[model samples]
Target: MAGGGRGGTGWSSLPADLLLAIFALLSSDADRVRFRAVCAAWATAAAAWCPRPWLVGSRTDRSGRGGGTVSSFWLFRPAGAGAALLRPFAATVPEGLDYLSSSRGYLALADPSVSPKAVVLVNPVTGRRVRLPPIGFFKRWLDVTTVVLSADPGGAAEWAAVAVGFPTTSLAYYSSAAGAWARLDFAAPGYAGVEHYSGRFYVAFGSRICALEADGDAPAVIPLERVDDDGADGSDDEPKLPGGSGRRVVETHLVECDGQLLLVSVHDDVVYSSDDDMGGLAVDEGGSKGGGDARAVEVHRVEWLWDGLVRLVRETDLGRNALFLGRNRAFALSAAEFPACRVNCVYLVDRQGHPDGVVRVLDLENPWACREETICPDDATGGSASSAGWARRGWFFPNY
Candidate 1:
């Protein structure tokens, strides 16, 4: 009866408002495309809707000689039910380009195999690529950790692509206005993460956070201060280790959500497992066969005061947004836009030794409500060996 009208009984007879409401409920781009094909009215309604974020999967082809060829990147629409299929773009992502980070619907990639390797910013949707000036050092020696973009390179009037890693003077940046790459004097011996928020760059080193201006001067490091617990009883204490000591903060991620800078601290406890008769073998909890370390994650939001100091606002909640952290990129998206996504949650990827390509979803509201999903399913690539081989994995948000 929705489509019943004086003109006819076809879907075209449906009211424009009703068509738009139906299109807005569709979570998949492919489904929306099909809906748009239904009629011109439906197409107009679908075109006006905004797109949701995507989880990107990338695997390397190690079968080839002298390193391996980088496989095509896959996009998955994560829904409350599960991950749904979205069209794969960059099927032949340029050879040697290893995905490092993603920001504002663009991917920052680099080739670690070659010296003076090329670093590039690419938008898979638009197939637009911008190459940064080559670094004169080897990837191994430099130990470049993460690269972040000030804005989407494809459309920003003036943008900056910054790379941070080990060794002194390890901060390198490319500015569109300058049209070249320049090294910053800021030295972070143990750099952890970098983020661009509210027209300024914030870098995380160990437990400290610093704000970097555009002039390339030395930024002041601000140490994190503890705040009173927001528990129902107004207790300032948190769960401690067996020995009564507080959990060790291993890593920190800086992110901007809703116009505020936040810091997510990763905590862990080293639990050693010893096996009998296997020569007193020791292993980390939840670790793979050879080795692994188990960690308990605690994410916190930082509140910047008007007096120029910052404090740990809270650790138990993320409000209406969810965070994605990995490969030096940390982003927050509103849960309202993606009904399937959980609010106050963190979606993380493991980019280290394990190549399982598992994506873990951690709920901030309830730490125990963690879920793991694999990005590369066994049957995804038609039995290819590279099907489960991921050179890098990240979160890619499409611009509609």
Candidate 2:
């Protein structure tokens, strides 16, 4: 009561440093947001405290609740040898809105019920919404892989939202500062992913990271120096799994961890549901690897040379942070800050292979080697159940 309650004479009068000290101990992001809402002084002191991310797309079984308007979001924490804690993070999102991309604590969801399809940014926890202007050139909103926000919606300043897809190299963005949705085209397309790092937005191609300068008007792309079959342990080189699993595809993501940006490459091995000559990728009721799982994963440190280019330095281990990658925009969390998170590890949802929504928990220290863990919604039976669409919408840092 001495530091954070009411008027000038009451708890709000305490030193700003003391309020921040208490904020550090609260742990959860929602608790910190509540603390900030105490008063203007408390909110000012908490401006610098960044909370760990909570995965975005978790839903309770429709067996109860009659398929209401809001769908709950959850965070999966490692509980024991083979268990998880599916804690409710954002519990009030609209029912039918499919999660397309997430940024600034809001999910860019596609409304499929409509004829042409609409994209709306929804703050899952608060039920706030921002309707973006439709790009006439681009009608396919669901195909967008990731959405990046310049700042949180409804804030004092103007903000922007950028949507990117690996398969579709076209950049479709909406800037509040500019007042309309614009699509930026590229002459040569080789981008595998895109992410915001430091102060600039970057696109990934092979082992290259390029900054997209002057986005809305007169944009220019600059790629970093590429490494070829180099490094002490072939880290920069795109990794390949031991020859057994048929038809493998590796996806790369740029993640900011412990003050530096990291390039993470994941190899998803394809599996078929039956022994019959299947025409396409299908999974029935199986394919969960336990006992030192050998899913190939690689992490590389991005060393910015500053003069319009950067280089990739191979990282053998992540000290205390775990990188979350899958369907959602990639984010990193420290185990020291969030105890439930496993240090030197990765929680990856298989978007390419698994149909039953089985998440692979890989140990970063030894990418091929991993411990057994079972992650699923608390309401569901296990990972064997059909939840492909829900599982693909991964985690996000819900700011509020």
Best by TM-score: 2
RMSD of each: 8.0, 7.5
Model 2, range 1-400, lDDT digits (tens) per residue? 5544545467777688898899989855557768988889898888756555655553323232111223344554454534445564445567776666677688777655555655788875456798876666664554556777767886748776667755655776667877676766642243255677776677664465667775547556665655433444323333333233433435667888888988776654444333332221112222354222234456778876655445667676788987787754687888787776787777776542233444566665642233534454333436624443342356666665
lDDT per residue (tens digit) for residues 1-400 in model 1: 2565566676776677788789878655556656877777777776666565655544555532222234433334554546433344434255656666677767667765766776777766556788787865424433555678888876778888777765435567677888776656555444467888878777765446666666744333343343333423212223333244435555567888887777775545543232221121111233332223454445556766555555555455667887877656777877676655557666665544234455555555543333423343332466664434665556766653
Local accuracy by lDDT, each model: 0.58, 0.60
Clashing pairs in 2: 55-395, 56-395
Model 1 clash pairs? 59-390, 80-340
Work out the TM-score per prediction.
Answer: 0.70, 0.73
State the number of backbone clashes in model 2: 2
In Å, residue 199's CA in model 2 sits off its true spot by 1.5
Q: Which segments of candidate 2 are over 4 A away from where they belong?
A: 1-35, 41-52, 58-73, 76-83, 88-90, 186-191, 227-249, 270-294, 352-355, 367-369, 379-391
Query: Candidate 2: TM-score?
Result: 0.73
